[model samples]
Target: MKKTTLLILLLFSLKSIGQQSKLKITIDERIETLYSVAFFNDYFLINNHENLYKNTLKNKLNILKNHKAVQLFDSLSTKYNFSYYRTVEWILQYSNFPEFNKTKNKADDYSTVSENKQFLLEEFKDELIKFNQDTLFQKYLKAVKPLNAKIISQVQNSTTIDELPSYLEEYYGKKLNSYNLILSPLLHAGGFNSEIINENGEKEVYALLGPNGEIDFVPYFDKDFIETDLILHEFGHSFVNPLMVKYENHVESLSSKYFTKELEKNGTNQGYSEWKYIFNELLLRATTIQITRQKFGNEKAEKLLNFEKSVGFELVENIVEILKEYELNRHKYVTFDEFYPILIERMK
Candidate 1:
């Protein structure tokens, strides 16, 4: 009886670990608070779901809109190119307000921040904390708590989140410490991702995603949106970006030949102004197509491939073909990094 009980306990422990290994989908309070401030400051006014917040948190927005920190954020955004993912990345570096200490360090492989901007963040730290305290940001978070819970529940119930970690690990040949899929209602349709490399060299990747639609004023996430493509593309960056950096010279040489003026204009409009950015996007989009093909089949993959071409990644289908070669000859290449040179060579 004792031996049988021990075996059962061991099985349960292993099951728990297995469940933990899957991607976690939830809303981040820190992100909610940060974007609330940005929304009040009129930063993301162009694409943000302004009516959702305006209808839901009218009283809180009325009070917090005039806060000193919101004013500072508005001023800084006007003074510099401080918009979009840069603002989100900066907020993710800090602890939840009140303490608001730097959670990320220089050694961390996160977003790039200019020295002047870094100084400004340091200068603004105290006021940020004060804004959270005085404006009762926690109350604002509380108001949206039900919506947050609903969004998380909707995503977590999807099969795609369960499958993503294993798929990413199998393709990239590296395991991340964790995958955090954060639901950010304040963001526009686009998503942002970044990696935090700990001192122990373990990587925790984060994807800040927005709602696909809304029901009444509450943010809604359809299963289709939570499926492989959106989340996969974001998480793919953590794997592909580093490899691009490693082979930067080769990528740079090939950029001028492939990254044409029309492509450049389209890419810049989408915030991928640099060649390296376009390169990363191409590789990631191509990989997503491959992943879709493997998981769903060829028709869906073809659809995605054509969609990418329409959006300016004309080279994506070619990259997808190369990735197929890598997939078929995994014993020879072993990892995507090992097979990366072949991609560069093929581009040449």
Candidate 2:
């Protein structure tokens, strides 16, 4: 073909690709929460100071006014749902997600490069030692040691996963024969994976109960740590699914009706201040749960012993960037597959 004709054809092909491309922008939901309300609620939960609830309304509104989302949402507050947490994801625009097709370029999946845990643990001892020196970790270790002893003691007598069924039935007083789950959480080197469910949900958590009705521990322990406390937290959701389902309906029954009415208010307040209040509240209420733990108790010694707060403050700084990125990419549906790297980048 002539050079001029070839150039024309190439231009047309490029134009066609752009025309057919699904890279068009779309509107994010118009509804959103004002910082004033979310921040106030967070403050009350965190400090347990009833006076925080009675703060001047003007002071509360000023807290999160700097936040861009707070401003945008405040302008469109009329379109919001009952709560921002429940209804932030107001729309789903279905399209082909961005695929890297990086099978050839991607690193190989983690594998058993070593023969066993004894060798792997030894090899990674330096990294392990670093985590071991945590001042706050003494209590965590004390709690885990007894649990580890229980498993080790059971290993000699309770040989199989089937044996766990009877052991659990006697210990827990529940017939779990029908509810079976197998967990092998290979912390050092294992593929974190899934369970049988009605649909493919990335966030689903399930466990296997043996014939006698307990965690099928022995079978999976050689392969992984099945009884990690984080696992129990996931199972708790399912355990109280019925009660959690009705919590919204009767929330006022368990609490003062006046307070409930205040929480439902919305005003465009400063976003950062609002988030600080809410985030601090979460930190306070998040239980350590060895037996029973309370944060910032009336005890003077407890109040004096405090985290530097620098670490958490830094974490919040990076999370704000993450929130901004999410807002900017609502049209593109861009997302970070892993937030850890950004966290490290900001911290270190």
Best by TM-score: 1
What is the per-residue lDDT of model 1 for residues 78-192, given as tens digits with 9 covering 90 to 100?
7756666666677766777578877664324543446666666665567677766764665666667776777677777765668888888888888777888888877766688
In model 2, which regions exceed 4 Å deviation?
Answer: 1-228, 252-348
Question: Each candidate's TM vs. the true structure?
Answer: 0.91, 0.20
Question: Which pairs of residues collide in candidate 1?
Answer: none
In the range 47-156, model 2's lDDT, one tens digit per residue, is 22222212432243344334443333332332332232221211111111122111211112222222343343232223222323333323333433443444434432
- For model 1, what is the alpha-carbon lDDT of residue 179? 86
The weakest ten consecutive residues by lDDT in model 2 span 23-32
* Count of steric clashes across candidates, in order: 0, 14
How high a TM-score does candidate 2 get? 0.20
Superposition error at 64 for model 2 (Å): 44
Off-target runs (Cα >4 Å) in candidate 1 are 45-47, 50-54, 106-113, 199-201
Please report how far candidate 1 places residue 248 from its true position, in Å. 0.8
